[model samples]
Target chain A: MIDFAFFLEIIPVLLAGLPLTLLLTTASMVIGFFLALLLALAQQGNRRIVIWPIRAFVAVFRGTPLLVQIFLIYYGLGQFRPSLQAIGIWWLFREPYWCAIVALSLNEAAYGSEILRGAIKAVPRGLTEAATASGMSKLLTLRLIVLPLALRNAIPNYTNEIILMVKGTSLASIITLMEITGIAQGLISQTYRAVEVFVAAGAIYLALNFAIISALNALETRLTPYRVRA
Target chain B: MTNIMHILGFQQGGWGAALLAASSVTLALSVLGFILGAALGATAAAGRLSPRRVPAWLAHVYGTVFRGVPDLLTIYLLYYGGSIALTQIGTLFGSDGFVGLPTFATGVLAIGIISGAYQGEVYRGAYQAVDRGQFEACKALGLSRYQSLRLVIVPQLMRHALPGLGNVWQLVLKDSALISVIGLVELMRQAQIGAGSTREPFIFYVAAAALYFVIAVVTASVFRFSEARAWRGMVHA
Candidate 1:
């Protein structure tokens, strides 16, 4: 039997973890977006040094599972504690929160860079030429004209990546962060009511994703008035 | 490099065999789930394309709910809730005992359900791309509904759907790593156990990651080869 009262009771308990989930998603996304921009731009250059390493990094991240990446960063990197300690950033890797964030950010960077690179490539050559004809430097053209247009084009795919990261934050629970899924796992152990508790937890995620989807749609519509149906 | 080989070696104390076995589990999980998903996806696609209002709306809801949610959460729900639902269904047949789904079955079902949503979209798109004239031609031939779909629509849909389905296969393969949470002895979980006992997290995880890469790259090429064959002689269309 479905228990409405029990579902209602767990909603507050689960919502307590909502902040951590939101924090993980937002922090990683903001950091990841900037890193993605760097990675995307690095490949546009003629130098193999920058492009090869970034390309390799993106491929490794995209090719493997995120869970493996998390383990590699969280547990595997911890094995090199002495070297990490020597580098003076061991303190960051020592904490599960930072490890989770780093893993998530790196994964996002991989996917986002590709999305951005595609968007940048898809930008019309004439637009960049027009920018150059207006007497702007290459850097100035990229900054003023190219990057903005690529960003607008990248929004839909980037929105998907963001939604993926939001779902991805649930992995943080595995490293002992009590995010929504982690909290649900805990509640199931305590109450022995897996179905009811998970149903409630799923509803919260459904609501969260619904908000994201609607916001992204609105932004997509607002930015692309040209896409409006006749 | 010698040290790396020692860690990855298959002899007594090495993780190579365990890692390989786990890779098979991962492959089987992905393939079986994809098969089930393809079937479900076809159904959902049909529902969405149906003229009937309810089935179309339900299919839309199915796609929205599965696609919008995190796959990790979906797997967890199925892992825990599926067994209970099974037990309840058992009760109607006078069975009183708890009916449980093994971790593998549960994982497969979860992957199937999640991938089905994406597959549905791919099928629907492919269905849309099937020339409208093809359907009319089928009707003109006095073909039955089922025969029309079989004789005319499906072959073209398969051609268009191959790439999208390939993408979904990669996703499901990566997502299979999540089944580790429920203690399935798939590659990721095996890596976790090997790493924990060996205290060589770097070696085991790196090995696991390498295996995943090999599987992904190889399978992707397979998809590409098949896709090429599928598109052969159809370029002008």
Candidate 2:
């Protein structure tokens, strides 16, 4: 008994939220990627003082649910508004959009750093040793030899993280961001056609993820030209 | 510090008891959802592995659609759509009014279906990872399919699936938090209520996060223990 016409009609409405969803995903992924790189690089050193704090950060973020993280950032931070204002950075915490971005980015960083760290560790040690033997410094060995291989290795896994971030963007709706899920929720309230509206919304997400998967697959093929095809 | 304790404490005005009760609800919801998911996952895995084309295609579609879409959207769809569908079914049976599903039931159903999709992949992978020779030996020993599956294949499959299942369990536990949006009064929802009533969101949320972390850590250790036991007497390469 689904209204086919209604399903077609809501596509344009849901598409309106596409730009914000893309923005949230891209912005958080970019920020999170850099933070994750920094974290992974820091952990390359065996210093307990440095790695312990990062380990704790990853454990806490990965252990708790992202919804709790979002609520903690948005409403919980309001509890410390005066102190934040005094510190001159209350502007970042003031908007729900910013709060969502912060939480999403932090969450992505925890997961992404682990993926990147594993990739980095998987790089062949002989290659790096050979690079160092050829008059390259440790920094050069990492930059010229280790990083490229690790990044290529990391792409397949990072694609999953990216898809996850795209999915994670839907949670922004809960904090009133007017994203796809937000608009769909609004439409459902008005029309009481939850199934149709959600089906349309889910279609949009499915399309987005499919595109992402294809692009990453293409990237993986392009980067690993040396890979043997079975 | 004392004020923080007073608010979270088990005293008259404290929210400790309420939060504790809500955590139990969260645990129950997740455990039930996970068990349901495991059953669905096994069925879906069987479908995927079947020689028939239709079931394999249907199972593939289920995995792709569920895995691609957000869990929040699925929960919302089920929460809103279930009642509507139920009412229509009720009307067909001559029972008139809107037949709404309870929030807890909806939550469990949502989590079950979503986790089932992921668990299907885990089970399929584990099935493939079972050594080919074992199956050959089972056939050579003149064992029937059901007997071999029950006695030989399934145990090894469970052993291989343990790590993946542990991951899915954590995912299901975390997803139970989203059930709060539908107002199930679990840990997340209880924290929200306490935050609103007491106007102390930071404390309540921090406390809630700690509780979730503890649960995750404890369950993880249990999985690790079982994994170690499962690996007992096995030779490692």
Candidate 3:
């Protein structure tokens, strides 16, 4: 009745696939951060052209489910094989890994842009005005004052976004990416013991998220030393 | 554009009708799950706020475990485990051997459990947001607890809870896609089926995404309108 041997066999296999999950999360977060930063910065000075398009883009990306987005990017785009081949980008489009990354990064950019915008808004107007009065150039003000404060303020929201990305990476499994959950599903097909294998996968995901949370919390404390002192 | 239109058309080969039906199923599942979650959430939220030891402990465990794990695992467990549990129950009740569990029921159960975890937090937060002084005032006026709750606490809690509940509904809607893995013919599953059958993965998947986008945008606007109406008289900065 016991399946201790089965558990032993699957744990290592599932762990092997965790790196892809982590890689997707990290790469997408980094890429999304840059894209989000650019969008957030662009939305600052312009309300007519730049802001509207970004707003629409963010709304579409954030409003819908990640599963739909992933399917659209992976299977949906695969329908354009001929066009992609014509454009010489079929190699990239043909791979599920690239599709997963693209979907995750675009999703994160929408959310990260919102967080960045909020952080920018939270920056006290008085400080920005004082910088302006002090003859600090716009670029210098952004580098020295605006970004540091915004980054500090955005830490909590960003942590939420990061953990969400970690969870969202599991959706890649639907597209045949053998991440942790995908491997777990495979194990279930092999063993027919749903509870134990899922529990193992859940434990893995929870452990990873827990580590991220603790690290982010420490970063938050380090970034806001005043809070630690208080 | 012509190819896109033809693939999405209502012809025998087209997936538009099938995907649309699946979207309806997704909507139905979300509503069912949201309602189920609200009931459980209310109970859990009350238990959490109760001045008792046992209920608080139960509530604590439920919240912690459900919130800590990924929703996908929760869904997978429900989808696979649900049939096993249901078949056992059916046999116990003297039904035919191996009573089947539909994917829709399984999907609803999964979505409900996950949404309940979130709804519990929302209700708990909303309960805390209810002004304590009003309860005191109602008591001063000699209103019974049920009457006071029905007249005062419930309305305020519902208003504050609306936005959070709306958020959980959207979350539930999106998460319904996960149930497709269990072979539920929801939107994503339908899209997958269309992709395989038509060999037009790109067209079908994009259409599915667009359908989801439309639903999300419309529902979000409705929730926003309700929030505005609910808080019409109150001043919020």
Candidate 4:
């Protein structure tokens, strides 16, 4: 009952969509990381006004599903086309690719900032105090001492978020970007073999995630040599 | 603003009731999936903890594949592949017509399977956190394995598992939105319909998001309360 030959044939076809999927993942992750850093750092300040808005932003994005965010950004924003055009940025909203990137990046920022905040908080106070006591500026201390340590601490959790972003790019198919899932769905429509197509697609995703997990595992080990058990 | 209110109002030509009903369907779908996941999780956790090599290896494969793959793909697989598999079984049983799985059942099964993978890990971690001395004490008391497990081990397991399971519940709740892809009339699909019909995609989508946020917030507090209750009278670390 299994279409082994057809599955083998479709693997190459599905691989054709891998570039777009990787592009979406990388673009969103890079953009989101910067935004998350800003949000995480802003969260460190004692001001209520800055902190509350950041908290609300994280809550809204984290509370709602990524599908809703994609829909809201893609179709929902389309309803305000004239205003968007007036702002001279309708071009960005018009493309499904950009919309997906924006939605994915925003969603990533929400979760990533929380992970980063925890990592930043986990950085021992004594280390930062030492940097400050050595006649270092706050900016210098953050750049030279706190950030590197916090980033290393953040790697494991951040790796999970990156995997999630990769998986999330699949939702872009709903908006018509031809990612791997999108290509598989297209093939299923033509071939009427949903099982084979999806299995092939799922295998591709599994392979991608395995690669990501291994690479991240290696990175984690490399960054934490001091923690290596004898 | 007035137009938004009117469109969302619970009056003639308004979609407030439909949205509310759809939100309930979303909630019901999530709760059902979560319940199903808990059962599967327990079984998988048991398999992982078993002394047998094959069951543990099988459990490991199950967790890795399900957790590593995207939930959307899992939903699609169940929705499409499940029907085909059911028809094959039906034919073997001498039925001629197709035996399609209902969309709601497929949604529950997909979410249950996906969440079960994560929940299994949570259970395994929580199980490890249970003190080894607790088992010794149970044995010292001459409690049977079944009695000790049901009365002693499970409670401690749950106390540690509550926080992790809370995170899993949030994930399951969000994942339920993908059920809309298979044409389930949950909150996301209902919002799509409302948006298409009214051409006010912004308002409907925003309303749907607000409804989701409310559910998430309310359920999160419920988890928090339960966690507190579970830890009541426990000594602080």
How many angstroms is residue B8 displaced in model 3 relative to the true structure, after the best TM-score fit?
A: 2.2
* Residue pairs that clash (backbone atoms under 3 angstroms), model 1: none
Tens-place lDDT digits, model 1, residues B133-217: 9999998999999998887789888889999999999899999999998889999999999898879899889989999999999
lDDT of 4 at A4: 78
- Determine the C-alpha RMSD for candidate 1 after optimal superposition of all C-alphas: 2.4
Best by TM-score: 2
DockQ of 4: 0.74
How does the DockQ of candidate 3 come out? Answer: 0.59
lDDT of 4 by residue, B1-237 (tens): 899989899999999999999999999999999999999898899999999999899889889878877778777778767777787798999999867679898889988999999999999999999999999999999999999999999999889999999999999989999999988999999999999999999999999999999999999999999999888889979
Candidate 2 structure quality by residue, lDDT tens digits, A31-87: 999999999999999999999999999999999999999999999998999999999
Worst 10 residues of 4 chain B by lDDT: B75-84
The top-ranked prediction according to lDDT is 2
> Which is superior by lDDT, 3 or 4?
4
TM values, all candidates: 0.94, 0.97, 0.92, 0.96
lDDT winner between candidates 2 and 3: 2
What candidate 2 keeps of the native contacts, as a fraction, is 0.75
DockQ of each: 0.72, 0.82, 0.59, 0.74
Fnat scores for every prediction: 0.72, 0.75, 0.64, 0.71
lDDT score for residue B117 of model 4? 93
Query: What order do you get sorting by TM-score, best first?
Result: 2, 4, 1, 3
